[model samples]
Target: MQIVFYARVSTDEQTAAHQAKQAKAAGFEIDVVVADEGVSGVSTALADRPQGRRLFDMLRRDDVLVVRWVDRLGRNYADVTETIREFMRRGVIVKTVINGMVFDGATTDPMLMAVRDALILFMAATAQAQTEATKEAQKAGIEHAKGREDAYLGRKPSYTRKQFDSVVDAFNRGEAVAAIHKATGISRGTIYRIRDNRGQAEAALARWAA
Candidate 1:
């Protein structure tokens, strides 16, 4: 049985090599590497990915599959849960680098199976919830940016959309200007500008959101 590592990179800055290095650092005896670069389909099935399909073909009963996290298996809760369950059913052990979790189907105990299944459900649900939250935050920032862009203000916002969102969120949370600056790595002057003129700042963020 092979010990395979799967790396899925969503951004250009993320690298399979780096993930492999991390896995090695974690003391996983990796025998093979299967990677899908720039693959971030929120609803895509693991079987559908170009390299993801290779997993079904390569993995066998008792083989160990390692990933950075449960989220890397799939994006949505259903997909993640189903994929892990399927692998477990096939006697393939699923291991995660983050916490050294091992999900194996070698046992015949009913109670243990019940507990494992419940844990899988909880983790998958958490991953999906996080994905939804990120999309909402991005949407808010984008809308705010568009508002500023249509207004055609000459003084453009210096901060990126992410930075603008951070500043806005910090102020709305009643954080001090100095605290916002420190947390978001933005200048005090810019944080004050974002705080003092909320609408204008959002408009700038919305424009950059596009």
Candidate 2:
């Protein structure tokens, strides 16, 4: 009956601690806090996240996995649906702090199951759409960057490269995702991107290492 709280942020400036505090305020006795920083939810898959992957690995039957929202679980339709279903099948109860959404496997009513599944599918699809829109926006920004390459002095990096490395090291060592977010202020989306684009992020980090 362990309760696990998961939070994520997109940059080092945002802390998951706030989310954890919210979950605690909601009456969840959190046994662990998992946070992923610099993980962009828009492009990163839940299954590919370091802490996300660890969640699947560490979660046992009857454990409660609490997140701020379904979006926190993922932003993609297929990924979100699949992840939730898998956890439900494994006897994990997925709960959300914002809306008190609960998805469990114990329901025997076929209609209830169908409705639950459908809701999950719809929400996941919406999350995916949101992510896609974000990607397009980033693409536009990059294009803008290219146009100004000559006159533009690049903005300072959001974080020192070493900090990114440290985050990754902590992730690899199985540090809780919530802890990482609290310490680094990185968003959940950014954490996912970090896990998905380790090589690229590492390269960026190297370029910004100072």
Candidate 3:
């Protein structure tokens, strides 16, 4: 059975690689990697994305699909839940890098199944909530920038220009937030803020003149 690692953006491609590496380190072998760049999981359904569609079509019974997190699958709770169930129904095993969570159609026990279903719902819901929170924070940052332009410029980023650019490039290449943070010593929030808000990040970088 083929093992596939999927991601959303080019930067997340790195995340996909990281996941593959982690899987390998854990004794799993990967056969393929797919990613869809510049797509928002919050808005797009899995079947609608180009690579996402390919992923669905490519997977076969007994194939394994690896993701950095449920959020990479989709941001909406229903979509995430439905996608996992569909995969499970197809005999495909869906696994996450974080927490090494596994979801499959292997159990017939009603209690066990119910517990698994509950976990799926919780994780998917948490993914959706995190997406909403990120968007809200992005909006808040922009709004705050509008009112306090000087303050925005004055605030120093935690990373130097060289450091930030390298991190940003890593992100643009599809690295996971956690992986990038681990390698560069940058905070996860800063990484997301830089990746999601390039204009603002660059403004801050210009102010630093690093």
Candidate 4:
């Protein structure tokens, strides 16, 4: 049975590498690492993503598929739930690194199955809600910057516009905050500050001619 580590990101090879290392640390020997870059878990269905399609093709009965979290599989509640159930139906074991959660189709007890299914629903719904909240926050941040454009310029930037944009792109592509910081040499706080308040930071950066 092949053990696969799947990641959804902007195709940063490092992300897959990181996941592989994580799985190893958890004592699972990975046979392959798959990733689809520039894909949004909120909008893209699993089968439609490039590497996602490959994952479907590759997984077989008894194969183990590992992800960082349920959110990586999808942010839509229905889609996430259905995808996981389908994989389990096919005898593919779904495992998460976050809590070492396991979803196996081998259980025949109806009550236990219902409990597992309910947990899947809860996690998927929470993931979707978090995605929506993030979108709302971004919108609010942009709107907040429209009237007071100069307010954000008061502070000295720890990173330049080029550096900030690079970090933002990686972050948007679903790269981990720590990975982005390490790769770009940007502090974690600055990367998040620029990401959460992109409009204000961008406007201020432009005004300063950065």
User: Global lDDT for candidate 1?
Assistant: 0.77
Candidate 3's TM-score reads 0.72
Q: How far out, in Å, is residue 61 in model 3?
A: 2.1
RMSD in Å for all candidates: 6.7, 9.7, 6.0, 5.0
lDDT of each: 0.77, 0.72, 0.76, 0.78
* Residues 98-210 of candidate 4: C-alpha lDDT, one tens digit per residue: 66888999878999898888888987887787667555544654565566754655666677755764575555446788978887888898888877877666655655555
TM-score of each: 0.73, 0.64, 0.72, 0.73
lDDT of 1 by residue, 1-210 (tens): 899999887755457998788789999999999999878747677888999999998899999999977877876898999899899889899998776778888867999888888888987887777666556655665765553535655566688765764565345435588767765677898888766765566655556442
Cα displacement (Å) at residue 82, model 4: 0.7
Task: In model 4, state the lDDT of residue 94.
Answer: 95
**Candidate whose lDDT is highest:** 4
lDDT of 3 by residue, 10-98 (tens): 33334455555766776657788887877878889889999999998999999999887787888799999999999999999998866
- The stretch of ten residues in a row with the least summed lDDT in candidate 3 is 10-19
How many clashes in each structure? Answer: 8, 22, 8, 1
Using lDDT as the measure, what is the rank order of every candidate, best first?
4, 1, 3, 2
